[model samples]
Structure formats: C-alpha cells, structure tokens
Target: MSCPFAQSPRSTPNRIPKRSSSERDSIYEVIDAAPLCHVGFTQQEQPFVIPTLHARSGDTLLFHGSTQSRLLQAIASGRPICCVFTLLDGIVAARSAMHHSMNYRSVVAFGTGRLLEDEALRQQAFRLTTEKLLPGRWETCRQPNEAEAKATAIAALMIEEATLKQRSGGPNDIESDLSGPFWAGVLPIQTVIGKPIPADDLPPGVEIPSRIASLTTSG
Candidate 1:
C-alpha cells in the first residue's frame, strides 16, 4: 500500500518545511541512523513518553515488548501515538545568544499502533528488528523459540502522517553579530562504537562475528 502521507496535498500544519527530495532523504537518513525512538501516547488520561528500539519496514514502523507491558498494551488499544527520532549532528555557537542553535535531523510521525496477531507477521517483525539491530548476526544466531515468541508482543504503526525537520551548518548570526569578537562555528558530534568485548563464558575459538567487528568504528 502507498504511504498515507504521500496521498495528500502539501497544505498541512507542520513545523518543518519539507519542500525537496533531498530533504525527504535527510528525514529517512535520520530515522535509519537513530536506533531508538520516543513513543508518546496517553493512557487513562495520563500522558506517557517511552524510549524503545524501533525498525522501519517500508511505510510501517515496528516495535515490540513484553506481552504484559502496560505500554505495549496501551499501544495495542488503537490509540494514536507520536513517534519521534532525532540525531544531533553538531552544536552551533553564535556571537549572539539568540542566534545560537544546533544542527539536527528529526522525524515526527503520527500513527495508531496495531498489534501483530498473525504468527508469521510477528516472526517477520522479529527477524527484521534483529537484522536492523545487528546485520548478519541473526543468520548466525539461533532463532527464538515458541515460548519466547508467545511472551513477546509485536506491534506495527502505519505512518499515517509525518514531518521531518532539519537544521545544519553554522549558526545564522546577524551581520552585526558576525563582527563581534567571539568564535562561531559548528562543533561536530558523532556516535562511535568501541571494540566489542567477548562474554566471560564465551567458548574458546569463537571469534568475533563480522557484524560485531564492523561496529568497532562509527559507520
């Protein structure tokens, strides 16, 4: 099915201005690079925002948790949810405090979570999630057992509406502020993965998997 967001006119209330194909790519890049997302929803008149790992499958976003988890249960109830993912690229220092800003890419999506009732779909979701977390490791690792799958609750959110906001480069300092005696530039930031440490009980001759080895540096 086509993405719901793609079916409508561009006249919508969104904070960010997404007017180009490159900007859409930036949105997807941020979502793919960030492993965690904050899901916001309300339960019993109380608002909640929880962080969890997520995987994007085409126009749908997948996430799972314990079957008995209150958050998962709430989501499965069909209430609307707001999913947010962001990546901080740098800090912009400007001569004027008002002009100071940061470089970031963010995606805000709105959808209602649907529980994956079909066993086959749930299994597929699990596989997709695992692969997204660590590519090539799922093939080498053992699959989940029936009992484990039974205890897990998987859900998919069809991205009905979404918006992407991004800010890059240095601060937009005014002409007068540009002449001030103050340093102004972007302080680049990145997330790096350190060398993997083997488990204490790891059997001998078991070398690091290619997926793990590849994570030794920032990808």
Candidate 2:
C-alpha cells in the first residue's frame, strides 16, 4: 500500500502549507521520536483539543486516556482527528513588529482514530507510555494489574495525511526596514531539567537513575 502520510500527487486546495513545501520524511521521523501530542476531535460540533500521552508505532499513534472522556467518545463516533506536536526552540525578533517570528518544529497529523480492544495491545501501549517518559522504565516498574488495564482505553490512529512546517534563521524584513532602529534577533527558549525531587515515600537510601538524571535539556 502507498504510504498514508506521504505527500499526495493530487491537488490539495484547503491545505495549510501553501507558503512552504511540506517536509514529509523528516516529519515522520520527528513524530516517531516525540513523546506526546495535542489531539483534537469534535464533540457535538464543538472543538476539543486534548494533551495526550501517545506513542508512534511507525505510522500509527497509540493514545490512551480515561475510558469516559468525551474526546474518546467522539473518536469512537467517527469524528475526523488531528494530532499536533510542536517544539518551540526560540522567538525570532525583527526590526519591525510585522516581522516578528518563532524558530520552531511542528507536525500536524490528520487521521481517523479507532478504539483498540485487544488486551495484549493495551498492555503494550501502557508499557510504551512508561518508556516514553523514561527510557527503560517499563522493565523497572511493576506492570499494570488486570483491573488497571481494564479501566483505561487505548486508541490507535493511522495517520492518513501529515505535514511539517519549520521557520528558522533571521528576520524577514523588507530591504528598506533592515536598517531600522529597533534591535532584532532570536530569543532562544528550551526545556531545562531541574534537580530531581524524590517522592516523599522513598526510603532514605533510594537514588535516582542515571538515565533520568542525564536529561539536561529538551525542546
């Protein structure tokens, strides 16, 4: 079968990437590496965007949430879906207000989601969740019990269409405005890992793992 998330040779009129060419290959790589996504689906004709813990198994996204959430219900009811993940690295400043911008990477995935019912698959999804938060965590922690597994719902979304848009480098001001009096540059921002705060119930000699302690920064 043709790659679902790959660029279409056919015409697209309502597309968002009219100004920039879509980076399809790089986007799939990033989506596979990223840990979470903001998934949006409509409920009663109203919009809803939910920050969800997810895993990308190739082109499929595994999203698990409370069994009773409306978003899950909407997905089950056949609403079209979009999952977005953005990494904002910095703010780009320009000489003029009109040229202000941000240096970032983001992916928008368009797909329809179906609730996953296989018990084994649900357990694997939960395991993927722990691994996403901390590599190698699935083996270290106690596996989910039967009751816990049944209480949660796991859904898989097959990405039918996707795109990536990136804006980087210097300001895009007109030639005449390049020499404007206002200062202009990018103010970079990133995620920093703070010192570990151990759980209150930890024993006196418990220590944090090296894998977690080494996460110095992220975007």
Candidate 3:
C-alpha cells in the first residue's frame, strides 16, 4: 500500500529547498528514535505547545498525560493537533556565517486525537509507551493500579499527514567560499545512555535489566 504520509500538503516542503525527505523509512526512523515530541494545538484562537513522551504504532502516534491537563483534555475531544519530533546530530561550520547550520532530522505531523476509552486498549497504550521509552520496562515495572489508570489519559493521533526534513554531512560551501581561511567542518553529536542510576529508596541487591544495560553511546 502507498504510504499515508506521502505528499500531503501539510507535509510538503516549503523551506531549505531539497531538505524535504521523500523516503518513508527516513520518517519512521526519525520518529522511532525520538523520545519526546512537541504537540501544538489551538484554544480560543491562541496557540500552545507542550512536550510529551510519544511512541509510534504503524501510522499513528500515541501520548499520554494527566486527564486534567488542558491540552490533553482538548485532544480527547478530537482537537486537531500538530506534532513535531527533532534530533540534532551536529553543528555544520561554514566559511560564511549565513551558510552555517546544524545537521538534524525533523518531522511534522498533523492529525486529530481521540481518547482510548476501552480498558484493554488503554492498558495496551500504556504498555507500548512504557516499553518505547525504556525497552522491556513494562514487563519489569509494576503495572498501573486502577486508581492510577483512571487518573491517566491516553490519546492517539492518527497521523493523516506528515513530513520528514533532514540535513547531514559536512558544510556545503561554494568554490569561491572554499578558498576562504575560515574553518569549515561538521562537529558530530550523539545521544548516549549513561550508567543507570537507582533511586535512593531502592532495596539492595537489585541489578539493572539487560535492556537498559544495552543502551550506549554508539547505539
């Protein structure tokens, strides 16, 4: 089947010329690698954005929060929302200051969210989100109690339209600018998981799980 995100007007490129990504894999990769996303919505003609943890399931993206949150409440009522995920990979230094920029992967998605009301579906959403943030965590951690589950709100945004824009590699300088004395190169960056820190109240003799232990600077 054709990709649902392909060529939607909201997902089309309008800036940076060729930076708009056409490959669906690139879009999914960006979303999969990001732990947080900025969700934007409108209320009374005013715009607001909030950062929240998200997980992608097929063409849909899911996130949760306290049911009392204004943004979550609005989304639960079928409000249209714009979500953005970004990963900055490095700094590109160029001969000209105007041409200097950063290497990054970014995606913009548009959709209307709905509350997952069924208890079974809500538990599944919770499991998926927990595991996405920290692999294998859902199985190891305590499942939410009835009170906790009732207090939380889970919403899914069916990503009807989205776009992935990214830039990488070294500085792109013209022949004229190449002869300049200014230094031009890319300063690479990465996201690393440091040694796990345990809570002060944790009981002794407990060890880190294999999944959490596997995270590192390279991967």
Q: Where in model 3 is the C-alpha error above 4 Å?
A: 1-8, 217-219
> What's the lDDT of the predicted structure labeled candidate 2?
0.74
> Model 3, range 1-219, lDDT digits (tens) per residue?
355465666668878758886566778899999979999999999999999899888888888889888878777778789899999999999999888999999988888889889988888899999988988899788999999999999988888778888898988888899888999999998888877778999899998777777874433
| The 10-residue segment with the lowest total lDDT in model 1 | 2-11
lDDT of 1 by residue, 123-178 (tens): 89999889878877788889999999999999898877676667888788889877
* Candidate closest to the true structure, highest TM-score: 3
Model 2 pairs in collision: none
Name model 1 segments beyond 4 Å from true: 1-26
What Cα-based lDDT does every candidate model obtain? Answer: 0.79, 0.74, 0.85
Candidate 3 achieves a global lDDT of 0.85
Say which prediction, candidate 2 or candidate 3, comes out ahead on lDDT. 3
| Residue-level error in angstroms, candidate 2, position 149 | 0.6
Task: Rank all candidate structures by their lDDT, best first, as comma-separated numbers.
Answer: 3, 1, 2
Model 1 gets an lDDT of 0.79
Candidate order by decreasing TM-score: 3, 1, 2
